[model samples]
Target: MTFQPLEQALHEAIDWMLRLEHLPASDPAHLAFEHWHAHCAENRLAWQRVNGVLDSALANLQGLPGQAQVASRALRALANPPRRQLLGKGLALLLLGAGSVSVLNRLAPVADLLADARTATGERKTLQLADGSRLSLNARSAADIRFDTQQRRVVLRAGDLQVQVEPDLARPLIVATAHGEVRALGTRFMVRQESERCLVSVQQHSVLLSTADGSARRVEAGQAFAFDRRGSMAVAPSMRTRDDWVHGRIEARDEPLGELVEALRPYYGGLLRISPQAAQVRVFGTFLVDDIERTLASLGETLPIRVDTLGFWLTRIDVK
Candidate 1:
């Protein structure tokens, strides 16, 4: 079975689960759900798969911190029409045994959905701004565009973006993140928001990288920089591979397996778990971002690791 069909079935099953959660047994929706479930074998399988995990998880919910709050928030979000789809995706991942409630909470794409521009998992998008600048978002990325007479800014809410400035001297183009801001001095550059730090790679001219603190640094063409809220510093120029995602590829040169897995997660639809020992293994290669299974197979062939997949929703990499 293809992953897409199963994924769609799971999503539909989740939608039905939410709708029927508070409804009475005689609710009209129950009959409709029964019809839908009987419509195909995949639907029956998906319903069973979801309920199997949900039943087990719910049995232990009391022992799990914040599970109740997470469930409440998910239900509340589902009640909001505009947020239903995004919340459904998050909830499906949660009930499918992806992670802890806290982890799933953080993985929820609420902020991404509210951004001016965003891309779904395994999807990429490019936008032509009002200022004639070009902004390209990597998979699962989100950014808000703000334009004014004084300045033009893109607030990157998540993931990575490559921006090509139109060069309006009247208003500088700045890309902001939790760590700091990248003021485009030249033409093009890329900024990635990581958990603890922000990464900037200049492809055209230069960018003025400023941290949340007062410090600033000039990142010239072909250079890369990384910073946290507290400080900033230059990184290896080889960090240019950071933009490889723009082309649906990951170019890893002696990169840690964990970092590579992190890059792959946004492109993969399911939860990808890696053991610490497997994560520390060094990798060097170019892999397609979209063909996750093929990439994993290649890694398994070349690296000392075991890749195990559970249906279409979970994959684990462990040291062999």
Candidate 2:
């Protein structure tokens, strides 16, 4: 998502335009939005390119109607409403659906129809990787998977990994992580390429985790754990399933506060400051990791702690 300075300025202006919704029309938000739009050739070019406002509106109305209804209603709104109301709602929707519209049309070579997915810092994602097998990448991670006849492979450009495998008679899927590699031969597993180590866990089928040094381990299902540059450790039942966070929940059996907070960081952005006062709090319930603000509110209710906002979506925990 590289952007030129003009593009960046345009993005900032778009934010102001959207924020105008909270102010009185007399405040001149629309006027400001227009002024910025006409600031220079570059500004206008950037404004024409940023169509995120439209993307958001369309995403919000995904199942209700297609883009045609939206286009017609927008024209209709411009025709029927007062100058103020029409500009307010119509401009917002117009901007939302129009993100990168011109840029996309011009840069046709760079279009991605695949809903590009992302993982935040310390955030991980586990998804069924086409072959009925599953792959999970650690926080600050990304991978593009494609399954073909020759082999099923995952190219892990960054982050730690843990995988669960479903075998196919054709070829065992291989994981290529930064540290090294792991090849599965009918196995259930977890593999994490931590800062220095590539941990591999085999839950049911067999998996071979061969390090760069030529050392290897064959792990089994229910026997779950990690491996790195140092060595392999005992597989614990507790580490067997940390897969729930992606689906919006984390069911813990007395996990530590630090671990819980680390698990919750990806669902929310910005600093999630956990005061040392909560360093040792033991959590043992299922948490809704999705609506992180609501999760924080829930934490405030269940524990003697308060979630105080520090803006920029930053939050801190204080003893209630």
* Reference-based lDDT, each prediction: 0.77, 0.55
Output the TM-score of candidate 2.
0.57
Clashes of each: 0, 28
* TM-score of every model versus the real structure: 0.71, 0.57
- What lDDT does model 2 reach? 0.55
Q: After superposition, how far is residue 290 of candidate 1 from its true place, in Å?
A: 1.2
Residue pairs with colliding backbones in model 1 are: none
Error of 2 at 249 (Å): 1.3
lDDT, residue 279, model 2: 48
206, model 2: CA deviation in Å? 3.6
Tens digits of per-residue lDDT for model 1, 1-320 = 77678778998997787678779998899999999999988899889876665444444445656554454453354333323444455556665556644334333343455568877656677889998999999877889998988879999999899998898888899999999999998579999988889899988999999987899999888888889989988788543336888888988899899989988887665668999999999999898976677898899999999999876556899999
Q: After superposition, how far is residue 268 of candidate 2 from its true place, in Å?
A: 0.9
Which candidate leads in lDDT?
1
